[model samples]
Target: MSTLFPALALTLFTPLFGGLVLGLVRPMRLAGWLNLAFCALSFGASLLLARDLLAAPGGVYTGHGLHIDAFNLPLIVLTSFVGLTTAIFSRRYMLEMYAHGRVTPLRMQVYHAMFQGFLLTMLVALGTDNLGILWVAVEGATLATVLLVSLYRTPESVEAAWKYFILCGVGIALALFGTVLVYFAAQQAIGDPEQGLTWSVLHAHADGMSAPVMAIAFVFLLVGYGTKVGLAPMHFWLPDAHSEGPTPVSAMLSGLLLNIALYAVVRFKMLADSALGQSATPQLAGHLMMGLGLLSFLVAALSLQRQRDIKRMFSYSSVEHMGLATFAFGIGGPLATFAALLHLLVHSLTKSAVFVTVGHAAHIAGSQRIERIRGLIRTQPAVGWALLLGVAAIAGFPPFGIFASEFLMLNATLQSWPWLAGLLLIGLAIAFAGLFRNLQPMVYGSAPEGQVAVRANLWPVVVHLLLVAWLGLAIPPLLAGWLQQATRLIAGGGF
Candidate 1:
């Protein structure tokens, strides 16, 4: 076996194997610890794989039906790292839920099991070289998350789960049709029935594929995967799903899952743009992405002003950040694409940390309602301060990773489309103001009596924010190189 095989095996299968064992094992005062251990191992493996790929010539991992490159190595690393931190945070959160009788032993087992399975699905989606396999993995993720979302079995939770299922199911079906259309275009262009819809194969011949066919296929794809990305008009299912799910799941949704969906869109967008290069289809796909992305960003920014539920508010924030990232990618150049890539890492780390604080605050406040939760500076200082830090980081404050990425995006926009850059600034300013307006009162308002937080597991919160802080101050050269290479690959094609 290649040296890559072992690390890839560990990175890909450990979570599924752990999930199987976790499901079978009895919950021993809860085995959340086990989940943490598994995620740690997978994170280590992914890190190793990334390091090796970087050291490897061409920064590629080919063969074995897997295609790991500059583009996906960062994403895989991000997913694994976030999975570990979320696992660490959940160990504390779920144990508390069990103690309070909000979760039973069996449900805890299921949660741990499904959490690992969810990780497995994303790794699969990220790793697979084939579009069909990618679609399968994404669909698998939907199933895994639905169980996690409804783990509480509350009527509302179940309703949210059902809604997520129905919307994503329709979306997935459309994606399948899009995939078939891609294969049809590929088959016609490549004249190879055996090769199927492997991305490497499709990419090599994207220019030769039918423009009209590629154009229409991309529209379906943008809508199909864009729904899961929570772009507005297709975003109705997202807030409810985030609100009703466990906080850990909410973190995963915003930090990891949404990124994966957007990654899919990015993949298809690249393929669509390449396939129709220099034709009447000129920038049509890019225009579609920018249109939807701007719509989502502006609408979600306004929607955030109305949120009373903390999770729902942050969920909208996820939409806003995702839209911004999408818009950057849709703009499509070295700086813009690099900004989008960096934003994925920054947003995932920061938003997840924010959710950890949100989870802590909800428990401490005895409610997820913003009106009911007051005086975080008084009632629970640690949770309150952590929440403040997280909120500020997420709001793109100075000296944060988001700030760096957003600045790069604006600089890129001004150089190209100064008018759209104005819209981007307006959207971002509105979002920033809306988040502060809601969070200010919650953080600085009068303290509610009779509520207290448990001494929280602040480690994950500290670690994640610190990492984002580091990125903001200065992204390490190696990481910057990786982001730049990935951006170039998206813009100028394969390295």
Candidate 2:
């Protein structure tokens, strides 16, 4: 019982400690191994913390401005799991890059250190109880990821990194402004300026807060966090960043980081719901989300048809899926909210799996251009098959967790907004066609010249795929209960 706090502390601090050790070490190999071991340890700690959270579901753990609740416990676990898997995948992947002279030993050390820093920032964001501190944590993540995005030091990579930094930095600043506004709204209720910004205090007195201030605060928070969530009109930086960065970074960006930003938005959404009443905030937020989501879905579907880069195509697919998840939460009902949570889980797992395979394919084919990388099936069967299956799962194929979640979301949408349901189906079908058309040539066409067989780290890919399959086929009762409890929290039920 007493071990839970230490486990939580370890989960938050291990990565930072690892990053420091890696920075001081001379040899790149040792640094990489240390990064991997530290991530694994952090993941294990997260699992222990999750078990504690589940066993004592109603218990509150507070430290200074930090709060651990059911809402963020699962998220911390998922984020840590992705960080661990990505670190494992990076070991061999980075080594391969080093062998090719694409990365120097010093740069590899930097990559390892930055990766841990990125993980630490995400953990801080999820675990912090102070709204202002959460914004700062997210800002730290943005800065750390900017360094990773430009690791290659190419012109395109630099450009992508710059764009990502500027856009997200502005967005995060807006989020900070929104946080201040939330504190203002809560000050009257909580009666202490500092404690008013704590999530527990804010939520506890939410019903007594000023609705107008809450409404304004939500607008800022949505636009700010929505940019990070890759919501359309604000998602321009996402594709370029994904396409230009290393594929492993792309996987982490799509699979884990984006979800963390969305988690932040959902937390604020929950706060707004409590402050302004559920019907007041959710309705406005949902409509805006639904509109932006549909726009992103349609635009990305059309954009996918014209993609020349394989990574860019998948990047668009991320936007589309994110739009769908945003739509689900925006709809704001029990079933829709539950489905949104499911979609987040499945999308993170499946998208990361896809990127792992894509990274291997790009390595073997020696190019990310979609047309040049043909006959993956002939060149490397494992990677080719993984890519195909991963794409299928992401494109909403049945017996995949995404399909189940999407179906639930659509059902919920249809019951309330039939027109939006129609639009969702149309966008999905269009995106599916566009993605598969590109996938076919890559999977089954003639092998191009100069293709090389590379060693693929199949473990991470297999682990993610298996989780998606199992979750889709038969979710463990305990996991389902956790999801339900999380949904109930978002739905404003204490139990």
Candidate 3:
């Protein structure tokens, strides 16, 4: 428990310091290895933080306007783990891209720098206790990713970056306005400007805030943060960004960023629920989340059938999973919230693995177009098998963590709103068909002339998929207990 403070500091600042050093380092090999080293340091710190939290009295740590509880501790660890693995995957992938003259030397430097910067922002966003700081961190991540998305400087990549910038910029501005409203309410209730902006303080006094003000604030907050979550009607930028950006960046966006944004939404929802519990529309926030979640789920699943680019297709899958998690959160019960948390964990792991495989597949085919990628099994058995298995896990196949999480969510929906179960079933079926439709041809169809294997690192894929399998087969007692604690925090009770 005494290790908490230093661990937290290292987890948050390692990347910040790494980015500074990497920006100045000239050798590509050194830069790449340094990136991995920094992420490893951060990941190690997160593990220490996790251990400290598990051993601590209440599974929490708070100091210097930062807080860690069951709710965010798992997420911080997941973010760091994915960051480390993605760094491992990216070294070879980006080095190969550099070999082919896809990225200039300077752009590579920027890429490395921005990668660390992005991770730092994400860690800060998760660790901060102030809503204002959280908003700033999320915005900072958007900026860092915008740079990464445009690293290639292709017209398509640049266009996608601009779209991501404009949409999320507007969305985050709305979130800022909502934050101001929250602070206004907090000031009204707590009457301390500085502490009013603190999330712990606001949460402590949530019930004393005006219901109408909280309700209005929640609407803005959801739409704002929901945009980052890639919910329906605000998801147009997601596919393009994922498709055109570097595959490592795609993995980061799909695996980590969306979850961080959703964490923001859930935090606000807790405040809204507390404030509105005795009001006329106690479940107003929940209803809004449910509606948007369903819309995004159905729309993204249906859109999957229309994607020609492989990465774009999986980006839609990310949207669908995030939407499903949102719907689970909206359902708001011990079962539903626990399922949503598990869904986030598995989806992040599985989807990052899928993107890494897709990166290798694209390298083998020299293109990301689905039609051009063929006979992966013949060219690279490791990549092909990893892709097939990763997608299978992501599509909710049996014995995958995704399947278990989805089943739990379905059971929860059956208990709460049985009428909507059919829609969920249809969405899952459609998404499964959409993915395999594009995937089978790529994995099993005849190879085009000159198709050959690249030096693919499949360790990350294996690690992620095995964890997903372990979770599906059985949740470890320790992880299950952590999730149960988080569930109690969110749902006001534990199973």
Candidate 4:
């Protein structure tokens, strides 16, 4: 475990260094290459961490600031992979923006810098075993993303950035309060400030801590991090941010950032559940998750039917998926946890692939409005088919990764909460209908007047969809084993 320290360091600091370098670099072309180089390095480092995980004992910590366990490593790997793929897609997307004269060289430099910084904060948040540091890292990611969302400098972009900033800022503040409460609970037992705030310390002593305090702390944590996860009633900022930001940023927000926020919540949930044990308080927290998850899923599924913006439609899809994943985790069994893990993996891959194709489609049609963009199959077959494949995967079509996870979730939910299982089925059906309704007109008809298709980098989209397809058909032994480990860790750690 100690041997993996350097890989972890590389994984954490590469982005910080890249962001600093990119911010000073003048040439846009050089900056793009540097971004990809750094992302690739980080991805490689994460793979090394995976290798170490396979060989090592339980979780390891290089001190308390950085730690790796089955629970967080899957997320760490997914983030690095998405970071690399997004870099590849964005190279051309941003170049096209340059061609359109919508972005100056300085803007390009800032984009690259903020992009690295965003990745850095997520890595920090995921790697940390300290609640206070995790909060700081999440806040950093939020601030960095606000810069990315506002990069276009349009009125809509600026408004969306402000909305993200304000909403997530409040959410972060609430999360801080929750953290303090947990630490306070720990202090009552451990009687040491430094030890009280440590994750492993809290977990080891959790069952002895105040159950009522754990319950209240989890409420604040769930609402706080749920806000960042784009759960309904706190989700107004998500669609606007996705619609107005660069397509690459939209992809990360839905695919990466939301997951990172949920990662934080998962850690807190595990702690809270451990502290409360079989007390009704733990079950109450789980019920809160189910209730919120069910509400978000149903609301976002219904809301998707009304979106005119193509990006907004997919943004809502993200919300629905996050809600479903949360509900699965809330159920807290090995099967449900495995399903949640699979859903998170597939959703990240598929949603980002969809956005990559959408980025190109919007470029082709000169608009992101669903009513305005048409004939993608005719005008740009690659982009059209990528979108088709992605949409199918997201809609939970059979032989797709999402179907497998949803199937597992339903199967598990039935054994415990049959009524909630029925509700899950309804929400999935509604979301599917909403997606398919808008999908038909966009992919089948003639192009709107004055729109022209353009070439795109489709490799990233193709690779992601193929991976999702593979997962749906057959999850590899290695991947399956890893996910199983994660499921065991989350299930046992929580209760």
- Residue-level lDDT tens digits of model 2 in 1-495: 567788899999999998888877767677768878999999999888877766663745777567887678877898899988988998888888888887777788788888888899999999999888889889998988898899889999999999999999898889889988988888888878868888877777888888888889888998999899888888999998988887779999999888888889888888887777744444665666667777777888888899989999999999998888887888887888888888999999999899989999988888899988899989888888899989989998988899999999999999888877888888889999999999999999999777878988889998998899888888888778778888888875422
lDDT of 4 by residue, 1-495 (tens): 355888888888999999999999988888889999999999999999888767776644446367788878889999999999999989878988998998889889999999999999999999998888999999999999898899889999999999999998998899899999998899897878878878877777888888998899999999999999999899999999988999999999899999998888888888888888867655767778888888999999999999999999999999999999988888888888899989999999999999988988888888889988798988877778888889999999998899999999999899899978778888888899999988888898886666666868899988999899999999999888778877877787321
* TM-score for predicted model 3 compared with the true structure: 0.99
Sort order, lDDT high to low: 3, 4, 1, 2
Give Cα-based local distance difference scores for all models.
0.88, 0.86, 0.95, 0.89
User: How do all models score by TM-score?
Assistant: 0.98, 0.97, 0.99, 0.97
Off by over 4 Å in 1: 493-495
Error of 1 at 281 (Å): 1.9
lDDT of 3 by residue, 184-247 (tens): 8888899778899888888889999999999999999999999999999999999999889999
TM-score of 4: 0.97
C-alpha lDDT of residue 453 in model 4? 68
Clashes of 4: 0
Clash counts per candidate, in order, are 0, 0, 0, 0
Candidate 1 structure, TM-score to reference: 0.98
